[model samples]
Target: MGHWWDRNIIEPGKLPLLLALAAFVLTFLITRVVTRLIRAGKGPFGNVTAGSVHIHHVVPGVVLTVIGGFGAVASGRHGFGPALSAVIFGIGTGLVLDEFALILHLDDVYWSEAGRKSVEMVVLTAALVGLLLAGFVPFGVNDLSEDELQNRAGAVVSIGVNFLFALIALSKGKARTAVFGVIIPVVALIGSLRLARPGSLWARRFYRRRPRARARAVLRAYHHDRRWAGPRRAFGDWLGGKPDPPHPLERD
Candidate 1:
């Protein structure tokens, strides 16, 4: 009873969950505000990205990371003991989400150079590995208890979900976006499948969206490719072998 009270008093897990949800909502609100602010401040034609890095990427990411990290700590420490392990693991998970957001924002603003993209892949892979190893470290500080382990696993799952969301958002256009977009979601789907173990709540939720997401992907592909109405036309005859369709939905 005392332990329960202590856990509730010191760091209630529900608080973290509520905080995480609030952060998500706030981020969305901020996005809308920033969009309007940009339109008003930059003028209709002013470059939103011209010569300056916007806080949109950094601010929301920082807020989200904090929310996620706190939630992880709260959940893991529910029973008792220090939640440091949960916090550490949670932070790693938060980092992954932030990284995903950063990538999405970066892609939206500027195409990554091949070399830079490669470096990104390497760095992320390293970070994940390091985080996993940290969980297993046997420092004098409390080794991760069972709840902490579960929280760490949950954090990993959370990151995967965030990655999927990023993929869906980024792959939301025709042709050029389609080319890269198709590959990413498929990979994400595979990851989601692997994460979806029996009785895992996160896995269940992730799987639920798979079909709709796939449908969206198909529509995006068709929308982008439909612009190339005809086949094998000479290059100079029209842009990219065909004129842009009046609209992607207009069928022959």
Candidate 2:
């Protein structure tokens, strides 16, 4: 185990990344537990406020993030300082992403349906970081042979091709595929070659003139949503807690 760790993590200078990932996941889980307890009115935890203005955790998160980010930059990739900075940055990231929906909408929507965006962002972030921890270099460069990488032209072409495929996947609304394709080109290639989702940028621009293609896209999207929406919602609720139901006054 120690030999494997040395070869995979220590030798690669990823100890700080490992610490950060651990801290980030733990912070997020702890924050959710405390918040859920508060919502149930079963804990000592409560919202922080100053007079009439509520102070969100994101405030501290921003401060810590700045300090830790700078500290990491100054300290480089080794020693206790870098490790501590990574932990701080990860904690701050966890807190900030916990309220991502609030930041995005510039409103207190943490308990609303819109709040699910936070969960999705956090999950995506964790997955990407996990992939990095697993030694997946971005843009499929890790898969290139040493000889190919040594050739500047070949390397550029490989990276450019993979990135273009990822962009195409994104335009087709395959966000997850596009993101993961940075590490696995085949994923993006598959997504880029598939039918675009309904209402996606690709669909809007290209499918406008093709009724059959539009119809197929819509049908595929409907089936995809129908098959996955329930499980997705359930997963989000399990991790982030179910969103508060709409009040009668807000209901149509």
Candidate 3:
């Protein structure tokens, strides 16, 4: 284990990245706990207000992100400075992303269904970072042999092809597949081979004339959502508190 750590993490100067990932996850968890407590009116935590203005945590988050981002660049990756900077940046990122819905909608949406987007984004970010920490390189570049890597034309072609696959997956509206496909080309290839989402650009452009294909896409999407939606919502609510019940007028 120690040897693996030295070979994979220490040698590659990934300690800071590891620190950042830890800090990001911990910060999000802690923030959720505090917010949940505040919502329930059962904790010492309360909203920060100055006169009539409400001060969101994202304010300080942006500040910390700037300081830590520049500090990390200046500090380089070799020393304690980089590690500390990573932690700071991670904390800022957590705070900022925690209210990502507010930034997206230009309004406070915490505790609303829209707020769940923040949780999804945070989870996605953490998962991607975790994959990198697990030694998955983007675009399958790491899978090339020393000879192939040395062949500039071959390397470029490989990367370009993989990137094209990722792009196709994205066009199909398989975003998660596209993201993971960048790290593993096979994943992207699979997504590219699959039917596009019904409302996606790929479907609109290609499936429009193919009534059978369009019908299949819609059916697949319905089944897929039905299968996963419940579990996904449960997981999100477990991480961040459940959203408030819909208002009467908003109810379908």
Which candidate achieves the best TM-score against the true structure? 2
Please give the lDDT score at residue 145 for candidate 1.
55
Q: What is the C-alpha lDDT of each candidate?
A: 0.39, 0.93, 0.93
TM-score of each: 0.27, 0.97, 0.97
Report the number of clashing residue pairs per model: 1, 1, 0
Cα lDDT, model 2, residue 3: 100
The digit string of per-residue lDDT tens for model 3 on 1-252 reads 999999988999889999899998999999999999999999799999999999998898898889889989999756689999999999999999999999999988989999999999899899989989998889999999999999999999999999999999999999999998999899999999999999999999999899999999999999999999999999999999899987899886
User: What is the C-alpha lDDT profile of model 2 across 1-252, one tens digit per residue?
Assistant: 999999999999888899888888898899999999988998789999999999999999998889889999999766699999999999999999999999999999998999999999999999999999998888888899999999999999999999999999999999999998998899999999999999899999999999999999999999999999999999999999999998899897
Cα lDDT tens digits, model 1, 11-95, are: 4344333333334334434443444445457535333353686433444445545665665555554553224434333334333
Per-model C-alpha RMSD: 16.5, 1.0, 1.2
Clash pairs, model 1 backbone:
174-224
Candidate 1 vs. true structure, TM-score: 0.27
lDDT of 1 at 42: 53
Assess candidate 3 and give its lDDT: 0.93
